[model samples]
Target: MVRIAIDAMGGDLGPRATVRGTVEALAANAELQVRLYGPREALESEFSRLPKRLGADAERLDIVHASSVIAQDMKPSSALRARRDSSLSMMLDEVASGQAAAGVSAGNTGALMALSRRALGTVAGIPRPAISTAVPTQQGGRCYMLDMGANIDASAQRLVEFALMGEVMARRVDGLARPRIALLNVGVEATKGTASVRHADALLKEMANINYVGFVEGDGLFSGTADVVVCDGFVGNIVLKASEGLARMLIERVQATFAAHWGSRVVSLLARPALLRLRRQLDPVRYNGASLLGLSGIVVKSHGRADALGFACAIARAVQEVRIDLPRHLEHELGQRAATAPVALDRRGSGVSPCAKTDDFNS
Candidate 1:
């Protein structure tokens, strides 16, 4: 069975959402097992309320008692020093101890990244972990983007590392043979971006295995122009949050337009199915999990405000990564690149900085 661990008290809904998601995940996949870490009373209370039909699935579920929880506003440093007994920490402990293949949480993003790095460490030659997730493309495909806010400032070399990791993620998770990689910039020209982007572009062009496809602008993110888009955390985080906001605005406007008049209402009745599909396509909840790529173990962070179904989607993401053995593949890929090109593989740990808290639970 593929065993996964969860911080049941991590999100805004706490055990109310997590326990339900756990039971749902367990019921959906017979080969999956779960280790839920949270207060014993809370977990038991939630589980007891779930349908009796899921009782059979509960056989593979285990609850590990955790005494505390890390608050959403807690700093990563404080959490590391004072919240060792927190559910988030305990969940990562299960993964680090080899009792679980992967871990999932909807807790403080900074805390998760800090604790995970200390507990699981990063893969060799990787300075730090990058937050990555797939976004829907106009072509009905998905494009993977990284540094969604793991590190605020990344060097040219760090951008290169993100590129390599994102390429691997697209290939392994999406089954793309040679994912088209691009550097996110202001314009498609080599001379259009900052010094770091320009430098990284030069370096990527020299790497034969990377399949580098020059630069991609912000508009290109949804244009099906590239499979992997690499950028610093500052730019990437803004792009992600803005894209989500824009999607919500557009969807709401469309719905409002459909309800404006009797004539439109009649058409809306006929077009309901297509509109529902469009909403689902743009729903950020469907893409809830963000992988902490480059870590030695699998770690997925769910949006803190996510509902039960969204949390369940996060759990599913961890299971997929566990089965794929993503870290191993990343390590092997880095090793191969280093053996062939020494300059491109100049890897060194740039030690963790004080993790910054964001409005959303993302780092």
Candidate 2:
């Protein structure tokens, strides 16, 4: 049985949403166990509200006591230092200490990243963790996008690491054997993007393992041309939010259009099934988890405002990662990539310059 740690008090609804989600996950997957962390009395109040439909299944869940909560606005580094016993901190500690295989939380993004790095450390050969999640594409399939607001200004080398981690996620979680990757840029031309992206692009193309496609613009994000899109956190976050908002707006518009006039209402009734399908296809709740890839252990970040069903999706994602042993796969992939990829230290002895040779790929 795979056990996952959950921060019951992490999100907006605290234990209310988290507990229901855990129950739902336990009902859906028999092999799953959840260790919920939060204030005992508060969590008990939420537990008492669990639906009777999930009776014996509640046995799969256990709540551990935590003393405090971290505020959403707290600085990431400060949150890490201020509260070792916070629900978020304890949840991460469980996964790091081997008590759980993975951890899920809907807490503050900055604090989660800070605490996770402090607890689990980065996977071998990865400099930092990058947030990644699968987004719906135009071709009826989905593609992974990375650096979705973890590090706002990742270096060229860090972007390469994001690409590598994104590839691993696409393979391990999404079941893609050779997920094509693309760098997010202004245009497809080599000279179109910033120097860092151009540099990372050169390195990616040389990797025999990655199916490195050329650059993809903002419009190509959901074009279904690439299986994984890489970018700095700043751009990735904007695109992610914009895409989600746009999907919601589009779905609302469609719904309104169908209900506007008598004739349209009749047509809508005729196409209700397809419209429902479209609504489900564009629902943000369907994609609730954003993985912090490059951590030594699995950590899933659910949307802060997610409810029961959405939180259940995040729990499901954590379960999937644990079942696949994503960390082990990523570590092994890194070892192989690092072995072939040359690493030259900078003058300050700080980082590996993957693009050391101007003709590294062309050579």
Candidate 3:
């Protein structure tokens, strides 16, 4: 059975949303187990109030008492340092100790990233772990965008590495055989954007390991020009937030338009089902969150405002990631390339560049 450690004290809804989501996930998958980490009394009290169906499944649920809880406003490093027994810390410990295959938290993003890095460690050759997100594309497929907010300022070399990692993830998670990658840029031409983007583009085009499709502009993001989109954290975060806001605004506009006239109301009555379907298709909660790739173990971070259903989806995503052995696949790909090629030196001449070993560079 796959086991997951959940930060029960995290998120706006606290134990209620966490416990409810866990119960929902358990009900959906009987082979799964959840170990809740939080204040013993608080967890127990929440468990007691669960529906009879879930409360009876308590045998499958375990609790780890964490005397302290980190608040959303608390500084990540300070909260992590001051609260040794916080729920997030305890859950990460379980992951590090191999007690759980993954950890899920709807907590402070920075804290989760910091704690995960400290506890789980980064995969070999990965400079910094990236927060990868899945966005529905206009071509009826999903594209994986990486470094959403994990590393605000990444080197051109690091972005190249992120593209490789993102390709591995998209293939493992989405089963893409030849996942095409595009460096997010201001234009489709090879010459575009800042020095970092242009440099990364040059490197990507020459990297034999990835299916580099040159540049993809912001408009192309949803147009499905690429399977994996790589950009610095600052740009990726802005794009993600903007996409989310745009989706929300469209939903609100549709609602307002329907209420403005009686004929529209009648149309809306007929369109309610379709609108709901579209809403589900674009719901941020349905997407929930993304995995923190480049780590030894699976770690999913959800929005702090996520409700029970959203949290449940995040849990389900983690389960799928574990089932696919994402980390192992990445290790195999990186290792195989390393074994077959001459070591490419970095600026410091330490080792081979990540882009040097792959056999798919564009002429």
Candidate 4:
């Protein structure tokens, strides 16, 4: 059975959401098992109310006591130094110690990233973990984007690393062979983007493992231009959050349109199936899990305030990663590829530097 560790106390709703999500996930996947980490008494209380809800299937679950919880806004350094007993830390420990295949958390983004890096470390070819999530594309395919918020000031070499890592993930997890990878930039022209992007572009074209497809502008994100998009955390995070906000605003506008009058309501009724499809396509809950790629162990982050179903989706994501054994594929495959790749030149056109050192990055 694939075992997952849940940070039951990590999210906004605590075990109320976590336990229910666990039951929902467990019911769906017979091969799945979970270890919920939180305060012992609190977990017990949550379990007491779930007998009818989960029935005897609750036997598939276990609880591990975690006495503390890292605050939602807690700094990563503070969490690492002081919150070892926190549910988040304990969950990571389970993965690090090989007791669990993966860990899921709806905790502080910074804390989770920091703790995951410290506990699981980085896989070969990845010095630091990058936050990666899939976005719907115009071709009805999922496009993977990375460095969502992990490293704000990512270097040109670092961006190259993200591309390599994202490429491996797309192939292994999504089963894409020779996936089209692109750098998120202002324009498609080689001379249009920043120096770092331009430099990374020059590097990617030479990599044997990646099918680098030049640059993709913001509009290209939904235009089926690339299967994997790479960017620095600052740019990627803004793009992701803006897209989410825009989705919500458009949804509200659609509701207002459908509820405006009897005539509009009639149109809505006739278009119900299409509207439902759109809703499902754009539902934030469906895209709830973001992988902390490049880490040695599997870690999926859920929306901090996600409902039970959304959290369950996050749990399901961890299971998928475990089944694929993503880390091993990345380590062995990318590690071998990096060993033979040419050194990437910096803006100064320097051939080698400490930042581009492949030892730690491709370790």
Question: How do all the candidates rank in terms of TM-score, highest first?
Answer: 1, 2, 4, 3
Prediction 3 TM-score vs. true: 0.90
Q: Backbone clashes per model, in order?
A: 0, 0, 5, 2
lDDT of 1 by residue, 177-236 (tens): 999999999998888989999999999999987789999999778889899999988898
User: What would the per-residue lDDT of candidate 3 be over residues 1-363, giving only the tens digit for each residue?
Assistant: 999999987788888888888898888888789999999999889878877756556677888889888777665556546656889888999998998999998887777776777777666556477888788888567888877877777778778778878889888888888899988888877676888888888877766767889888887778888999998887888888888888889998998899788899898889889898888667543355678887788899876667787788889999999899888887677656545532321322222222221111000
The parts of candidate 4 lying over 4 Å away from their true place are 268-277, 284-286, 345-363
Report, for every candidate in turn, its global Cα lDDT versus the true structure.
0.84, 0.80, 0.78, 0.81
Which pairs, if any, clash in model 2?
Answer: none
Best by lDDT: 1
As for model 1, its CA RMSD to the true structure in angstroms is 2.4
Clashing pairs in 3: 208-358, 208-360, 208-361, 209-358, 344-352
After TM-score superposition, the amount by which residue 121's alpha carbon in candidate 2 deviates from its true location, in angstroms, is 0.4
**Which is the leading candidate under TM-score?**
1
Q: What is the lDDT of residue 36 in candidate 3?
A: 91
Q: How many backbone clashes does candidate 2 have?
A: 0
List residue ranges in candidate 2 displaced over 4 A: 267-274, 344-363
**Residue 16 of candidate 2: its Cα lDDT?**
82
TM-scores of the candidates in the order shown: 0.94, 0.91, 0.90, 0.91
